[model samples]
Target: MSLEHSGGENADSDLYRIRHSLAHVMAQAVLDMRPGSTLGFGPPIADGFYYDFVLSEALNEDDFPEIERRMRRILKQGQRFYREELGADEALARIDEMGEPYKREYAQELLSREDLDGLSFYRNGSFLDMCEGPHVDTTRDIPRDAFKLRSVAGAYWRGDSDNVMMTRIYAWAFDTREALDAHVTAFELAQERDHKKLGRELDIFHLDELVGRGLPLWLPNGAVLREELEKLAKELEFRAGYERVATPHLARADLYRKSGHLPYYADDMFPMMELREAGDDGEAVKEAYVLRPMNCPHHHSIFAARPRSYRELPLRLAEYGHVYRFEESGAVSGLLRVRGMCMNDAHIYCTEEQIRSEFKGVMQMYAEAYAAFGLSDYRVRLSRWDPEDGKRREKYVDNPEAWEYCEGIVAEVLDDMEVDYVDGPGEAAFYGPKIDILCRTVTGREEQLGTVQLDFAQPGRLGLVYVGADGAEHTPYCIHRAPLSTHERMAAFLIEHFGGAFPTWLAPVQVRVITVSDQFDEYGHAVVDRLRRRFVRAEIAARSDTVSKKIREGTTRKIPNLLIIGEREQADGTVTLRRYGIRRQQTLPLDEFEAWIAEQIASRALP
Candidate 1:
């Protein structure tokens, strides 16, 4: 993980220096405890710092307290941190004298590969290591009560699996004890709301070794969540003048090459499959196909299938297209990162003058969908290309003029809509610039949940054109958008956002009818039938358990509404209702309860 400050301080701030200095101090303490241990890399990370070491002995969680105590003693020594600069040969000699093989190897590699003029080393008391100097002047700058060693794990040297495994010691650091405590509490809450754990408990989705990693099998309940989301997307897209379309999951390799995704995105796509077919002359012909990693190319093919006129300018094609990607084994995690996903994807083919209006409509649709989901903690980012990058031709389409014009158009739209967005230089898509919607997860990390990319290269490459009113062929601009993202990612987000207790409409099991005793089983089934006829996802809990036990079970499953079918309620054609996360209960006529629930679901009311 990238380093992040616990107090929201940047790397050049005082808190960062303190954290960096603490890492060195911790290294000093560890070296004192294990005399022959050699250090690798010690860097400050999110919330704290960690030091990697090739230890002479094994370490475990049991040793954290003693190591922390030694660290505190070193902090009290008030050792001054001194920096020294040396040439390449001098640095290598110093590393050799220090008897650290990893440091010497890394120094040599840096000198040979990066061609650095020199190297810098820092020293505190008798301990010295090769590092750039931004450390605190003295060890006393670290607060004793604000930091604690978190855990020890094995990490490959320099994060390369081919290298030797080293012991990594992690610690949590903050500017104050209160901030550290608050972080601890929030971390615990995040663990409690972790999707993997809740997914199994709620029976939402599952991962099996046989089915393959990163491919989730959505259980019955999980399918409900997905279908409901797709229903919402279809309704919104239909009202916005979008025409739904379907495409195959795989396509010919030449298709991607034509769309400029082959050389740039080949590594992330699955291996190509070759087939032999009979040619027109009865000879064997070879063909190749691969699983598509995106839906835009296929949509472009649809747009180019027939000749078009200027009247069909802003043709919007939407699809829940299933795409496959070859994610690294280590990068695949639950539903967040997956190999197979059904993207809520679409492409808008519009003229140059119509680009702004079409793009603004997409943004407005996103706002409407987010408002319906009650999602407010998100920011819009204008990810632009960098012209000064050394490998600009390889990283981006080297069209400076098109890049400038498209980026200006997107910025103008955001300005006209009064949307607050931050500029993200060097983060644009390879084809062109894009607008990214980043939402903050419950764990305090921002994730890119949706995107709208302006493409100026693909349509021309794919030969997509329309006849203008002047009777000339003109290239149209394509806007690739996904407001709801993929079902897997959105479901994961909603699972965490609502803590698995979704609102009435989105809940997997909307209502459960519990019979007070086996005698009330008939009434429970009748009530469930009535609710199901009204299109509510209702079930009958007709077990021979007590009323209180049945109610507890329904609540545990996170059923939003529970209807009690007892003798008194059955006799009067009424039902006692209990809502999840609420303490009060009420008795109402069965017809009245049905009407109230239908309205609640129709309005998509939140708890």
Candidate 2:
């Protein structure tokens, strides 16, 4: 890690050495494929490497293999990587003479840096590249076993849109062929597990280009999941002493101004809608209404709605608030980031003394919620104000001591809980510090699935206060948290996590009661109705299809249980139970089978 190792030894890891060597080989391959191609920096990444290139022509998928061939040819020659130092002007002249404009520009920029040493170039075969090298001495060391050209993607030069958009070629290398195959297989499984693909296949949601890119239309199945989550949240919050409240999707422009969201978070907000009153006088009215980007502001309105006393200091108001934010078209993805979405959002206004207990309550609630879904092993990012910066007084409230004091309190709480957490400096919300729970997906991608933010600024900004025991006005602390962040995002994450084979309770279709013949179709219906009466998700496949074919279809849909009834079983008042993703089937009486299925569903058993 860059955190632990300021500089690294080249021989420490052969995987890294070969991967770094692969980047150089890839760049040489690009130059060979495209004559006027100018090279940018290509460094080894976490998995592999990607080289950014300024190409004379756009290279499509057809160009990847030729580039790979050129790379292999260079590898076969076993050319020595000869590195040499050159003056700023000399380096620019050499790159410019080779018609490598990107290299020349990079050289000029590095030349302006006071800390930069001269410049270094490494040559292999007929290709020479400008780079800082800790690379292998020769191309012979570059492994040929399990390397592959992944994809071609676009990236802005230095990630600046105003600059040239370069083509980036991604490639990966593994230490062994077996490891590479495992990675490839996992990637394929992830493709099937991809929410967007599975969402459409299972009829969950859809994104229409005409309706706008990031706005998703939830289908019936998706809506069923959303309502189920809301049912859970409402029940949980009710038992936890939360009062449900409703908020408008769009609020007056002045509301945001008071909340301090207008100017700072304006980029994330949608374009404001203008309203007007019409009359014969034709008076022009101009008032703005913006789609709320967050539910925190609206919940604050509820807090300030009525006069309060110290007894009500720990007021918990919750809302299933739908918000809208305009994400750049390029950044718009699936349910992860969307234009229209809802949150299981809530705010707790509590006294300074109640802060610790309230936070602990939230942590306990989060534990219970995740336990129900069997989601564990997550890292917590605790964002705190940076004390190193002397300007903390101006940035935070005048109570500099209070900020540090609260930081210590939160740290103590996390320590007492014995949770794994890391502190992030200056990553807090503009108002106060927060903690984001991050977890990696099945395919090794990190996701910020849920968050809990602590705030002390918004209440004061809105002039909210409660009468204290001392008969003085006081601001209450706010803890904004969401356990099941959003129906869209949670469904997406769980789909991938379970690989579409959901536990019985959450499955859209939990059981499929199939029968041996059309003669037994009536018995199958009877079985489904019996299960459904117990609140178990059950279905009957009464089509004129073979039993084996019906079983195949049921398994494909990932149904957890399949009860097959034949003439003998129907006469005996018994059923053969076939569980999905398992090796064996079992025979049980109807009552016993129902009881077992109920237990599995209630426990949310992993099949």
Candidate 3:
């Protein structure tokens, strides 16, 4: 049964019950404050609970203290929650009489449906509302000190813009107050490490209103990060026998329509651009072009661009191409969700016999990348098709046999590798099954770092064919993999993962040279020049400031290494080194330090 129907009775744990029950108590408190406020869905989320409502006056977070007092009073009264079942018609009548038009409309809609059996109503004191209940015996069971109202947001009823707008109040609750306090502390750390804030302080990237929302302009430092990532991907892809290819950012609308992306993905895609041209009959004809939302269709066209023999069966085309999507303003958050992005995308066209090996190679590539990035905690989720799920069945290609065959092939490959993975039904792409690499960031937010999708539908639909050894034409199976994710998303993750103190290999500024005094200015310039000549991202701080202040500036910018060139170090031809986030500093010979940094860069070593 769904959580909405389980009513906290069979909750998996005490925390779930506490969160769910707190949602009800908070709803009751809101109703008391505004007599006619109409309540909507109130469900417990990952770390908190939220209740949506339509009230006469807007609610501010500053008013949470007063609301908490009322909730404490309710808890003191020790009100017991009692449940009663009623017919759908009777529930509708009672809802209308109570002046909750939204609830009345919901009950009426349920009554029109013939599948429902009965409606349950929960009562606590004079407050009675429709709910499926397994609430606590009394309000005293709630920990009044453990919960807090977090914030309020504007949400459309049923999440549709055309529907009435309502206020959604978010609050947090836990089985213990300590857990709640810990969550708040971690949230503050996440804020401090937020990429949007660090991106500016480090001169990485910026999002400007004049340029447009969701389109970030990469600064010099950000471009260096992008270049380094792409360089790594290219070297790895080249080693995996993947050839680099480039594709346009816009394509003819017919391309997507033929691949069935138009019907399912039109909303997320940018609007089409129409062009009129003269046809063979001297009549004006219209053609529609749209910014590409994905790269698979273009890659498919490239595959079919020329006839192919089975000898070149596994043709892997890779690109760090840009794509555009129309994400809603509210859903956009920094680089994580953006309209423009550069995908570390590649498509492998191979015969059916080569699918397993190609997929294995893709998996190996992903593993190598994760290792290089020091990301060891991750899981692979096999997203398979669910024939019994009507929505998914309709969304996927209508070929149950093909779905079963592809899923079996993927399962066999995964087993052969002896890697652990969980099966997730109804998570497959519209055209095929896929494997998503899931991991939680340092901030405790779940992220999809990489994905490998096996497609049997799109290649054939696009007329992509290769001549078999038996002299017969066959459509090649395509494997779509993106091990490094996108440039924007990966940067965002890296920013937070390292807490902006990047390793020397990936750090935008590898070293900062600080002069102890004017007498050491020449020495500092010489040190910076030596490092820069060796291709190290080094800078000199010869300004008229205290040595401590210059060193503090370097540490604040998160430069991986700092070199202090003073009279003693200059006289000895040695550099006093300071590492970021480290308390101790050491002195190393000038040549030794350069060699050390060179090795780090060459090996892409983690700090």
- Whichever of 1 and 2 has more lDDT, that candidate is 1
TM-score, predicted candidate 1 vs. hidden true structure: 0.87
Runs with alpha carbons beyond 4 Å of true place in candidate 2: 1-11, 85-121, 160-164, 278-283, 384-409, 423-426, 441-444
- Looking at model 1, which ten-residue stretch has the lowest summed lDDT? 1-10
The alpha-carbon root-mean-square deviation between model 2 and the true structure, to one decimal in Å, is 3.7
| 212: Cα error in model 2, Å | 3.7
C-alpha TM-score for every candidate: 0.87, 0.89, 0.89
- Candidate 1 off by > 4 Å: 1-7, 10-18, 33-46, 51-66, 76-123, 128-145, 151-169, 175-179, 277-285, 391-393, 442-444
Candidate 2 per-residue lDDT, tens place, 62-168, comes to: 88788888888888889888987888778778887777777777777778965565788888777788876667888888767668888889998876788888899
RMSD of every prediction: 4.3, 3.7, 3.5
Task: Compose the digit string of candidate 1's lDDT tens values, residues 304-352.
Answer: 9999998998999999999999999988988888999999999999999
Displacement of residue 372 (Cα, Å) in model 2 is 2.6
Q: Can you give the lDDT of residue 135 in candidate 1?
A: 84
